[model samples]
Target chain A: MNILRFITAGSVDDGKSTLIGRLLYDSKSILADQLEQLEKSSAKKNDNGEIDLALLTDGLRAEREQGITIDVAYRYFSTPARKFIIADAPGHVQYTRNMITGASNAELIIILIDARQGVVEQTRRHSIIASLLKIPHVVVAINKMDLVDFSQDVFNNIIIDYSKVATQLGLNDVKFFPISALQGDNIVDRSEHMAWYDGPSLLQFLEEVPVENDTNLKDQRFQVQYVIRPQTDDLHDYRGYAGKVQSGIFKKGDRITVLPAGISTTVTAIEIGGKEVKEAFAPQSVVFQLKDDVDISRGDAFVNAAEAPELKSELDVILCWLDDKPLQTGNKYYLQHNARTIRTIVRTLEHKIDVNTLQPLEITSPVTLNEIVKAKLKTAAPVVYDSYDLLPANGSAILVDETSNSTVAAVLFR
Target chain B: MSAYQLNYLEELEAESIFIMREVAAQFEKPALLFSGGKDSITLVHLARKAFAPAKIPFPLVHIDTGHNFPEALEFRDQMAKEVGATLIVRSVEDTIRVRKLTEPKGKFASRNWLQTYTLLDTIEEFSFDACIGGARRDEEKARAKERIFSVRDEFGQWNPKLQRPELWNIFNGRIHKGENVRVFPISNWTELDVWNYIREEKVGLPSIYFSHERELIEHDGQLIAASDFIRLDPEDVVIKEKVRYRTVGDMTCTAAVRSGANSIDEVINEIKATRISERGETRIDDKVTEAAMEDRKKNGYF
Candidate 1:
């Protein structure tokens, strides 16, 4: 079965965790023993006779004590149709960095909107982040439908308001669902209360949504991770470059070029687990043997010579500051792109994104924690990359602090 | 451009291989924590594929509780040889004798917790900057919150709240001297996924995973494996049943399930029909408390 990795984002009390809990509970994914424990804990917490489904995703003791999700918590469940991995991110603006981290690898995103309030500020901020991250599919779940008497008018009004934001952000694939996560309506099964609505349930939409076509197959990009050389007597003089195929298809006799070094070679062989394969595609970890010996090392990349990526020493990037230390001009960091890590300096701060209004604010100060900004960066050495709009896996990078080595920013090249 | 994407198992394998390569490139001294379990065995297989045509870059470290199944020990030795990797074994028996730590006694006595001390000692002795293990998020609630590259303090304690934010495929494996990162490459895999991978890859495992007639004793509604370490009480009834282990841990604490699965295919089918979780049916350590896994992980138990 295919795996659908998604994220749930919403403001506090919008029931992000409750929605996930409902999905797990309604699908029979929650085991009997786990349900029993949940009941006991719910009774102890005394949530006014209501089982707090939020407690299920709040795994850390600190999160449980604070009654808020502080970090990204991953939850797994599977139906007969597909496997689901949910990255439940905190909704508070201060934890926007956590949301970015969760949404980075997500193929789809479920943005929850409380029915009473339509298209609030948090909703717009999250939508902008989703568009910025290039999430392929978006599901705006209008939660707490029971509170609004399951009114189709309320759901429709919210959709009308949300559509404008989606249009402004250039989100092409947006779906809407009205559901009561607490009362089990239109989440797993259809809701009888909403006779006016005619659409697949949330689970149904997730099961049918296509994800495989998102991979970039026209451009072949493979970053060499490690050099494999078995220096034993029997297998002497054997050298191979091992890595995951980031994009496109590679065949045994395909002509490939080693990046950064600019050496051309032919793929002599492609092996997966000591067995030779005729061809491989994106996301398959394989080792390639070249016909001609080349000086390739870790961080070097290989691509189809006809469709090579842009190679440059400077870049314009959108960065989300993740560390507590503010990002300032002239501050140096280790820019890690694929397997390569190079020394980088912030040459200029173009502007900080006002997430609330979706406007570019002139930067008068350094970028602080949880702030997103577009900046120009200069690297010490030339690097090979594509626009993130073209290829996400190869175009994206991270800025690590030189001294602490902590990832301080998420970089998207333009 | 043809539409091609990896299946679930292939995607998992690719991600794991990527993680293994990151550990190899980022850390100074790394080791694969081999426990002779199915998960760790799969990890070794991935590591082999990660750097094929070359010997595994890291050594295999085993914290022997000295109560291991004979088959597991033999399998561990043979696997180390096949990979041509260095094998380092640290014994809990020696640590107990030297440190004067008292072992739990009576019917439920187990050396499982004692292995932590030897493991921590081995890390310090070898100055290993990173230790890769086969821990999946689906196993326990605490594991669900763990980072792929989990950072441990000098004392080997996990601070869940202080974990660094892991984004995309980029993992932060930086730490000071004496501190280490515990890497879990298969964090996204479920129990069924592991079994399916094993079946597809034809990975070798200990014979005990297959059904065989063994002497067992019933304790607290569980079929406890009859072994020298287990001190059966008067009420405990011994029986000869065809059983297979869903997970292999300390023999004293690992329970067995009645099954006729003698091959990998049968095991996969049985697991598909099984209702209980792998740990729920086998591991006794996690049943101690609601947050037992979390507490143990905080104290540096892998």
Candidate 2:
């Protein structure tokens, strides 16, 4: 079965967690013991004699006490068609970092917009994040339709408003779903009340959505993670570069070039689980044996010589400041790209993009927490990278606070 | 034409292998924590595939609780030898003796929590910067919030609230001198994913995982294997049942479920039909409190 990794983002009380819990509960993913525990907890909290499904994803003690999700909580559930990994991201403005973290690896994002209040600021904020993270699919789940008496007008208005935000953010594959998470409408099964609405249920869309072609199959990029050499007598001469193919396809006897070193060699062999294969593609972890013994180690990239990625010491990037401390110009950080980590200095803070307004503000002050900004960075050594629009896996990097070693920023190269 | 897409299992394997390789490349001294369970066995397999032809760069560290299943201990040793890995065994009994710590008593007593001390001591002894384990987020509620590369304080405590934001596929494994990282390569995998991978990879596991006729004792509605270490209360009755272990831990606390899954295929089918979770059915340590796993993890338990 395939795995469809997605995330849910919405403000507090917007039913993001409730939607996730409903999906899990309706799909029979919640175990008997877990459901029992949820019931007992609901009774203790006296949730109006109704089981509060939101309590399922609120795993932390503080989150339970505060009745708010504080961090990203990954929930796993599977149907016969596919396994789903849901990153239930906290929706508060203070937890924007959490949402970005959740959406980083997500292929789809469910931006919950309360039907009573269509397309609020938080909804736009989440849409910008989904676009910034390059999430391939976007589903605007207009939740709490029951509160509005399951009105089709409310749902249509939400779709109309969210469509503008989606277009502005350049989110191409945006789908709108109208549902009430509390009443389980248009989630697992089609809602009879909404006969006017013609579309697949949320679960049906999630199951049938094509996630296979999401990867970039036009550019072959592989980062050598480890150099394998067994000095044992039987395999004394064996040498291979182990890594997952980031994009495109690599076949046996294909000519590839090692980045930074710029040396070309033929792919003598491709081995998956120690068995030689004719070819390998994106996301497949394999070892590549080169015909010529070119000097390559961890942090080296294997690319098609015909289409090498841009190599430079200076890069213009859009980064989300994740650290508590504000980003200062001329401060050095440890920039980690793929398997490579190098000292990088913040050259300039160009402008900060106000996610709420979708406008870039001139940098009059330091970039603070959860602020998205376009900046220039100079690394001590040249690094290989692609535009994030071209290939997200190879185009992104992280900024590590040199002193505390915390991941301070998420870098997306332009 | 068939679309070139990796199935869920293959994607999980590739992600795990990437994490293992990251640990090797980022850390100074790394070790794989082997528990002889299906998860750890799968971790070992992924580690081997991550760096084929070459032996695993690091050693395998096993925190011996001295209450392990005999079959599990034997399998651990044999697998270590087969992989040509240096196996380092640290005994919880030694930690208990040296620290003058009293073991828990009565029907719910288990050495699972005490294993934390031995594990921390082993890391300090070897100066291992990264300790990779097979912890999956779907195991328990507390584990759901863990990052792929979790940082621990010098004292080996996990502060869930203060965890670093892990973004994209890039994991920040940098830490101060005394601090270490606990890496979970399979953090995204579920129990079913592990079983499917085990079947696909043909990974060897201990005999206890498969169904067998074993002497069992019923305690607090849980079917536990009757072992020499567990003291039976008068109310508990010992009987023979065909059972299989869902999770392998200290035999004193790990519960067994009645099953006829004698083969991997049967086990997969059995798990597919299982309503109770892997930890909910077994793992007596997590049954103590709602935050039992969190409390133990805060004190450096794997």
- All candidates' chain B TM-scores are 0.98, 0.98
Model 1 residue B41 lDDT score: 96
Give the runs in model 2 whose Cα sits over 4 Å from its true position: none
Task: Tell me the lDDT of candidate 2.
Answer: 0.90
lDDT string for model 2 (A1-414, tens) is 799999999988899888999999999989998988899889888758899999898878888888888889999999999999999899999999999999999999999988888888899899889888889999889888889988998888877787888778899999989898999999999998888889999999999999888888889999988888888899888998988899999999998888888888899999987888999998988999999977788889999988989999999999999989999789899999988888999998888999897698998888999999999999999999999988998999999999989899999999
Give the best candidate by lDDT: 2
Against the true structure, candidate 1 has what lDDT? Answer: 0.89
lDDT of 2 by residue, B244-296 (tens): 99999998889999998999999999888888888889977777677788888
Model 1: clashing residue pairs? none
Q: Residues A1-414, candidate 1, lDDT per residue (tens digit)? A: 778999999999999999999998887767766777778778878858778787788776667778888888888888887889999899998999899999999999999999999899999999999999999999999999999999989999999999999999999999999999998899999999998999999999998898878888779999988888888898788898888899899999999899998999999999987789999888888899999978889899999878999898889999999989898689889898978999999999889999876799998887999888988999999889999988998989999888876789999999
Q: lDDT of each structure?
A: 0.89, 0.90
**TM-score, candidate 2, chain B alone:** 0.98
Q: Cα RMSD to native, each candidate?
A: 1.8, 1.2
